[model samples]
Every structure is written in C-alpha cells, then in structure tokens.
Target: MSKNKKEKLNVVYSTNPNFSYEFEEEETPETLDPKNQLLYVLLDKKQRAGKEVTLIEGFIGSDEDLKDLGKLLKSKCGVGGTAKDGEIVIQGSFRDKVIELLTKEGYKTKRKGG
Candidate 1:
C-alpha cells in the first residue's frame, strides 16, 4: 500500500475488487455583498514583541475573495500582511485607515477593542 493510502483513516483494506475511496469535498461559502458584510477592525499587539497589528475580522466569503480583499488593503496601506482563517492581519496599526477604506468599499465596519 502507498503512503497516501495508509494515511487515510478507517480503511485498512478493501476486499472488493471494484471498491473505490470516496473523498469528501469542502464547500466554500458564497461571498456576501460588500454592503452586507459587517467587518470589525481592531488593533492587536499580542505575541509580536509589542508591535501592533491591525486585525480585520467577521468576513463572510470565499477564500479567494478574502485573499483579494487582503491584497487590496495591503496595497492601500503600503504594508505587509496575510489573510487566512477568515481574518486579515495588517502589519501595523492602521485601524482608522482600514475602517475608512472598508467604508469606501461599501462594507459596514465597526471599531473593535481599544
């Protein structure tokens, strides 16, 4: 048996000659309209040596759409960041700017945390 087959759980061996493995696919949620999205912008300094990072959360959309939004924010802020796990993390403190940008894009944004 190949390493990949061995890694599959609950299937030691299939006696049936015509047996095939069935893999479940995850469905991505449809991207919501900008006006319908309620995004939260907040400043975080945890676990980064006291450096502040802006976190945008509460996004409801596909991964690709999330990534695209992240890219747009990074470019606008002229900073580096990442988008994953339904959150966007910008490298520095830019909460006001981020909220403004989101507003311009028709996304309902709220300031979160002091």
Candidate 2:
C-alpha cells in the first residue's frame, strides 16, 4: 500500500455488527425493497463462464450516490464491477469484501444463497 492508499484507509473504521443485522438477512426477490441496505449479487448462468466480473444491480435509492459507492467497493476489492438497475455488481464471489465495504460505508450488508 502506498501513502495515498494508507491515508484513504485511515478513514475506514471497524463496523458495528448491531447496525448491520437486518440488512444481512436473506430476502426474497419480491420482498426486497429499494430503500433497504441489503445488496444482492446474482450471477447469470450464461455470463459465468466468460467474465472476471459480473453484472449486479437493484441497489435503489439515490442513483449518483450508489454508483459512486459501487465504484469504491470495486476498487477496494481490486476488481472491476458496475452499478445498474439499482445494484452494485462486482465481478467475483466477493461477498466478504463487499460486506466489509458496505458496512464501512454505513450500510448493512449480507450474503444470500451459495
């Protein structure tokens, strides 16, 4: 890590588990609300074979803010990803990394399914 990177990391703090519980629960696609902190990264069957990153959307809320946040998450993971259809879709099984990023950003996050 370089000086700039270390400085940026200084801004990150340990996440409180209490604040993240609800957002981490497994939810049905129908019940998921646009305003929630929950993030879903669904992988398309056809796309799995050919890419290092996957498309994820359905984050909802302020578009500009979420998009920027998505980019931050992707970069922190050292991978490429995108934000679309209100979701932040990164290119790998980055559940733990995603969880850490979102939690640090003050959003409760969770991993669903296998």
Candidate 3:
C-alpha cells in the first residue's frame, strides 16, 4: 500500500453541498531601482489631526519595499508613521533631513510644494 496520500482535488472542504472552493495566487512585489525612480519629499499637515508629517511619494515598485523604506526613515527621523498607497508618511516635518538621507542612499530625491 502507498503511504503517501493523493493530492486533494479541492483546497477547502465545506459541509454545504452547494459550496465550492477556489484558490487564488498571491503576486510577488517587484523590485525597483532607486536610480530609475524619482521620489518627492513634501510637508503636510492638512488632515493629520493637527500634527505635521513628511510625505514621500512617487515610489515605484513593491509595497514591501515602501514599508521598509518607511521604517528606515522613521528610525532615522526618530518618529512614527505609516507607509501606504505607494507613499511614506513620517510623523514630523523632516523634509530636509529626509531628502538628505534619501539622496545619500542613492535615491533621486526632490523637495516639492513650498
């Protein structure tokens, strides 16, 4: 007798006869080059509950990369924030410092919105 069990036809089993299982594959995030992308550094406080934040935009590629970069920036600035919608929001007006750091990291950094 074969010890190995045959592969299941469905990934999930349901008690209901009408139920069917469908599997969806998750996509891997793409890696992007820092040199090919232009990042914008802007200061914003319009809808942030009256707190100032530095916004980094125009990042191309994976959300994971964005989050990692956001973490790095937050640590460097000694603040807290979030990375979403392809933008990194740091909880402070660290525009100049952020630009400097990003430029040092080989990213094309730009200051936008005076």
Top TM-score model: 1
| Candidate 3 lDDT | 0.86
- How well does each candidate superpose onto the true structure, as a TM-score? 0.88, 0.55, 0.76
Per residue, candidate 2 scores C-alpha lDDT tens digits across 82-110 of 77657677877677667666667666555
Deviation of model 1 at 84, angstroms: 0.5
Lowest lDDT sum, 10 consecutive residues, model 3, at: 1-10
Please report, in order, the local distance difference test score of every candidate based on alpha carbons.
0.93, 0.60, 0.86
* Residue pairs in clash, model 2: 53-91, 54-91, 57-87, 58-85, 58-86, 58-87, 59-86, 59-87
Error of 3 at 38 (Å): 0.5
Clashing pairs in 1: none
Please give, for residues 1-114, the per-residue lDDT of candidate 3 as tens digits: 232223334554568888764544446668678888899999998977988899999998888899999999999999999999899999888999999999988899889999
Query: How far is 86's C-alpha from truth in model 1 (Å)?
Result: 0.3
Better of 1 and 3 by lDDT: 1
**What ranking emerges by TM-score with the best candidate at the front?**
1, 3, 2
